[model samples]
Target: MPSAPPPVPPPQPISDLPHLTRSPPLPDFFLAALSLFVFLSSSSSRSFKLPLLCIQSNPRRFLKTPSMSFSHPNSGRTPHDAHRLHPFASPQSLSDWLKPRLPSDSFASWGVKPGTKNVHNLWLELSEGETSLADSTPPIRTVQVLSLRIIDNHRRILLESHQQLSDGTLRNRNRPLSEKMKPNETPESAVYRAVKEELGSILGDSDCSEIVKIVPDSYKMKIEERNSASYPGLPACYVLHSMDVLVEGLPKEDFCTVEEEEYANSEESSIADEAVSVKKHFWKWVSLDSLDF
Candidate 1:
C-alpha cells in the first residue's frame, strides 16, 4: 500500500522542476545559416590561395623606387649655356642626383647631349668664382672617380707615380691608375676607357678585352672628405669606384708612360684656351704585403 501511494505522485513538468528551465529549440533558419557559413569557410580555405610576403635581408640591395629618371635642366640649352654651372644646394642633394646617373650608359643614347663639365670640373669653376654659386647655399661639390687595382697572376698590384714637377719633386702621392668618370658614363665604360688611356702605350692598339679582364662584383666604398688640398677652403665629396683589373703580359719591373694633361694658363681661361702639359708617369708593381695603403 505504501509503494502504491508513492507511485501515485504525478511526474513534474520540466519548466517546474528544481534547477531546470525549458529552452526553445534553435530556429531552422538560424541553424541552416550557421551550417552554410561553416561550410563556406571550410571550402574557401581549400579553394583560395593566400599571397606570400617576401622580405629582403639587405635593404640596400635594391632601390625603393621601381624606376628613377632625371633630366638635366640644361640638357637642351645652347652650347654657350651648356657649360654654365648648375650648382646643387648641398652635398646630400648632389649625392642623390649623381648616384643613379653614375651608372648610366650614355647621354647620347638617351637623346641628351653630354655637358662639357663633369662634377669635379664644375666644382673647380664654381670655387674659383668663374661662375656664381647663384642663390644656392652650402656650395658643396662632388666628384666621381674610378680607380683600378690592376693585378697580375702573381697578385702584385700595379701603381702609378704622381705628376713629377719640373723641380724634381712629386706633385702628389703615388696611387693606382684612376680617372674622373665622365657624365652619363657607366662604370664598365669608364673602366675600359681608363685602361685604354692609361695602359695603351703598353698594350698598344690591341683591344682592351685582349689585354685585361675586369673582376666582377668587386669591393665598393664611399668616403666623404672635407677641404680638398686642390681646392682649399672648399668642402668636397669624393664618390670613388674601385675595381679589380686583371692584366696579362705586363713587365714585372718598373716602367714609364707619358700622359698629356691640359692646364689653364690663368684662372679666367676658357676650356678652348687651355694649354697642354705633357708629363711622364712612372709605374711600378709591388707586392701586396709591402703596400702602405
Candidate 2:
C-alpha cells in the first residue's frame, strides 16, 4: 500500500520555525541584543491612519485593512498601563500580582486578549540561537525595526516604517523589511533592509545603541498582539527587536513629506506657489511618556 506515504510530515507551523538565531560571523553580542527589542505600541487610531497592509503569501487578496483597533492606541489592553509594554514605562500591578514563571499561557499579565482572527501561518525564521535569557525566554510576536535616515551627512532621524501590503503587494510592499531577507534575516535583517531601501547603502557589521527617539510618538501601536490562534498561547503582546542606527552621511531626498501634487491645494495659483516641495523633517525620537493620544 505504498508504505502509507512515510507518515507525511506535519505542517511546519510558522511560529515553530525560528528565523533570527545566533549563527556565524554575526558575533555573540549582536545575537544577544536581538532578544531585547525596544518596540513601542502601534499608534493605531490616533495617527498614521491608513486603509490597508498587504500580505505576501496571498498577493491577490491579502490586504489588511486598518482595523478599528489598530487605528486606536488608546482602545484596548484594559487598564494595564503603557510602561510595562514598552520600555516607555515602569512595571505594574494591583499591588500583589507580580511574580514570574515559565512562558505558559499565564503570561497574559497585561490582559492581552486571545487570538480570534486565527492568524496561525505567519512564520519568523532566525539564524541565531537562544543564547541569552531574553531571547529564549520572552515571547516572539511583532518585531522591532530600526531605521536611521541620513540627510546631507550631518543630521539623523531614527524613523520607523511598516506598510501592511496590498494583497498583491504584500511580497512587494512600501517597506518590505520582512520579505526578501537573506538566510538568517530576523529583526536585525529587517533593520538593515529598511536602511538599505530608504538610504541605499551597505551597513557594515556595526552595533548601534543610542536611540534618539521612538517614532509614532508613542509605544502604543507597534505592539504585536493578535486576536487569533496562529500565535496562540503566546504573549498577548510580544516585543520585537529594535536598534539605534546611525544616520552618517545623510541625503537630501524627502521621503515622508506630502508631495505638493498630493496635497489639498486645489486652487491653480495655490498649486503653482506650493510647487516648491517641502520635506518633512523627521525627528530622532519621541519620549513615550509625553504622548497624549
Error of 2 at 130 (Å): 12
lDDT of every predicted structure (CA atoms)? 0.55, 0.30
Q: Which stretches of candidate 2 lie over 4 Å from their true place?
A: 1-121, 124-194, 201-236, 240-242, 248-250, 256-293
Estimate, for each residue in 164-269, the C-alpha lDDT of model 2 and write its tens digit: 2112121112221222222223444454444544333222333322212223332221445553232334433333343434444333342331112211222233
Query: For model 1, where is the 10-residue window of minimal lDDT?
Result: 61-70
Error of model 1, residue 265, in angstroms: 17
lDDT of 1 by residue, 1-293 (tens): 54544556788887788898778899999999899778778865566445999988754321111110123322342323323334444334544554444334331121122212233444334333232231223334456678889988786898886655332445453789877654445666778778777677777677887677888888575766674444333355666788888877667899876553423322434532331222566788878788865
Candidate 1 residue pairs in backbone clash: none
Q: State residue 274's C-alpha deviation in candidate 2, in Å.
A: 42
